[model samples]
Target: MITILMGSIAIGLSLGVLGSGGSILTVPVLAYGLGQTEKQAIASALLIVGLISSVSSFSGIRQRLVHWPLVWLFGLPGMVGTYLGAWFASFTTGIVQMTVFATVMLAAAWRMFKPSKAAPETRSEPSNWLTGFQGLLVGVLTGFVGVGGGFLIVPALVLLSGLAMRTAVATSLVIIVMNSFIGFLKYQQVLTESQTQLNWHIIMVMTAIGIAGSLTGQRLSGRLPQQKIKSAFSIFLILMAGFILYQSLPALFPAFTL
Candidate 1:
């Protein structure tokens, strides 16, 4: 329980500071730290991340940082894709899911490490069809891995939609909240008997702490350079990806470790 709490603080801080890594870490914390099965961890992660993101997004909305039109354009298809992805995840093994998740983390880290070439003033409105397609793909990946998919969304918005970095981050939160809630709902329907009984006490504590951490992260964001933060976060994600692959692949192929 202490370990889970500590891990939750890290998750919250990452989310608050980076606006994306909370969901990515939640599953590992639940599964490794709390002794939960992968499916249960995934379900719990969706709910936790959804609630945290919902709280975080209000600030963006209040500041008019969120692009309302893009929210609807990107979110509706994302919701559908989230539901479908959760349904598909129900049939997969833990090792398989973790393997795929680790692969995605690696890809995200690589993207983050690359220098951005986007010009702040170069705004281009992406077609609705392209935006919707991107959203759907992100949502599916999010549902499958129980992540917010902000890493993917932020980049897509900047590169495809040509939104500024701050706007993209804010907009990503709105889409994450939607996808996470829908994914949680779909995940619930397929829960096993063991998975049905969740540790609400832990979850509530984590949520509260996470919210506080996110608020702190928001404050820190003002003091920190975005490029520095991204660089550091990219390194962290690379390490995490390696750890996950190491843990999951051995389970999938026992002889590999032998």
Candidate 2:
């Protein structure tokens, strides 16, 4: 229980400070720290992350920093994709799932470390078709990894939709919230049995502590060195990938000894 609370604090702090590293932490925390199977870890992380993100998003809402229309444009398609992705995940082997998820984390880390040079500026509402298409892709990716699509959504909002970084973060929260709720519905049956494996006491404990951590961390965002924080956060992400690879890779290649 204590460990789960700590993990939640860790996740919330990451999200509050960096905006996108929470999911990377979430997958590992649930899988290793909480002793959940890979699928359960991914699914549970989706729920917890969504809820936490919504809480953290409150500041953005207060400041009117969110691009509300864009969120709906992206979130709807993402929900569809999430369902498909979760369906596929249900059939994959544990090793395959972890490897795929780890690969995604590495990709997200790389993107965070070396973001696109293009900066967003104010713009009129985007064309419906373009936004819908982007949402579809983001949603599919979200479903596959059990993430909220912020890693992709932030960049997309900035580059494609001309949203500022702050706005992107705020809008990404909506996507996370909506997709997670819908995606979880897809995994409802699986989660019922998983309830036995899940440490709910830990979930509640973690959420309470994490909310405090997140609130504090977000307050520090503008005051801190963002690039330095992002760099450090990337390191944590890479470490998570390494951990996932270490635990799941060997099982896939049983003949190998390492």
Candidate 3:
């Protein structure tokens, strides 16, 4: 219980502080800390993260950091994609799932490490068509792996839309929440079939505590040197990715193990 609480706070703090990278930690914490099966952990984590990110994005909204145009532009189609991805995930094996998770994290890490800084975004209304297309692509990725699409959204906002990092992060949070909901619905089918019951009390308590911690971290985001922090985080994620890949490979290729 204590470990779960601690892990939740840690994840929330990371989300609040880093914005996009926090979702990557959800699976490991749920699986390792709460002693959940891979499927249950991933599904439950998606539910929790969706809620948590929604709240966090609200804070960004409070701070006037959210970009509404981008949110719709990216989140609309993403919702559909998320459903498709979740359905696909149901057919995947644990080894394959972990491998895919690790690969995605690694790619996120690489993106964070070498972020492209160029023009700042101007606050303006966006076209409906653009939001729909981006949302579809992001949603598919999110639904497929039970991951927040912030990893992809952040870059797209920064590069294509010319938004600031904070704005990109804020927008990513909103998009992630919507996409997560889509994934959560698909995941529920499996959970119901398996008769899984998450520790809701624990989940609730952890989420409450995490919200406080995340808010504090969010306040610090503007003050901190994000690049340095992102680089350090990227290194940590890379190490974790390497370890996960190493462990899962043996199972995927049993012949190589012998």
Q: Which candidate achieves the best lDDT against the true structure?
A: 1
lDDT of 1 by residue, 1-258 (tens): 687678777777777776788887888888878888787888888898888888888888899999888888899899988998898988788789888988887887887778865845656677899889988988899888888898888888878877877788789889999999999888878785334766777778888888888877877877887677778878887888888888898889888783
Ranking by lDDT: 1, 3, 2
Output the TM-score of candidate 3.
0.89
- C-alpha TM-scores of all predictions: 0.93, 0.90, 0.89
Error of 3 at 95 (Å): 2.3
Q: Which wins on TM-score, candidate 2 or candidate 3?
A: 2
Name the 10 consecutive residues with the lowest summed lDDT in model 3: 118-127
List per-prediction Cα lDDT, in the order shown. 0.83, 0.77, 0.78
Candidate 1 vs 3: which has more lDDT: 1
Q: Model 2: per-residue lDDT, tens digit, 1-258? A: 667777888888877876666767787887888777777777777777777887988988999998888878888888888888877776776578788788988888887788444563555767888888888877776666777777778888888788778888888877888887777766665667456355566656666777787888889888998777777777878988888888877898887556
Q: What's model 2's overall lDDT?
A: 0.77
lDDT of 3 by residue, 201-247 (tens): 76677677677768888988779888898898889889988877887
State the RMSD for candidate 2. 2.4
Give the range of the ten consecutive residues with the poorest summed lDDT in model 2.
115-124
What ranges in model 3 sit over 4 Å off?
120-131
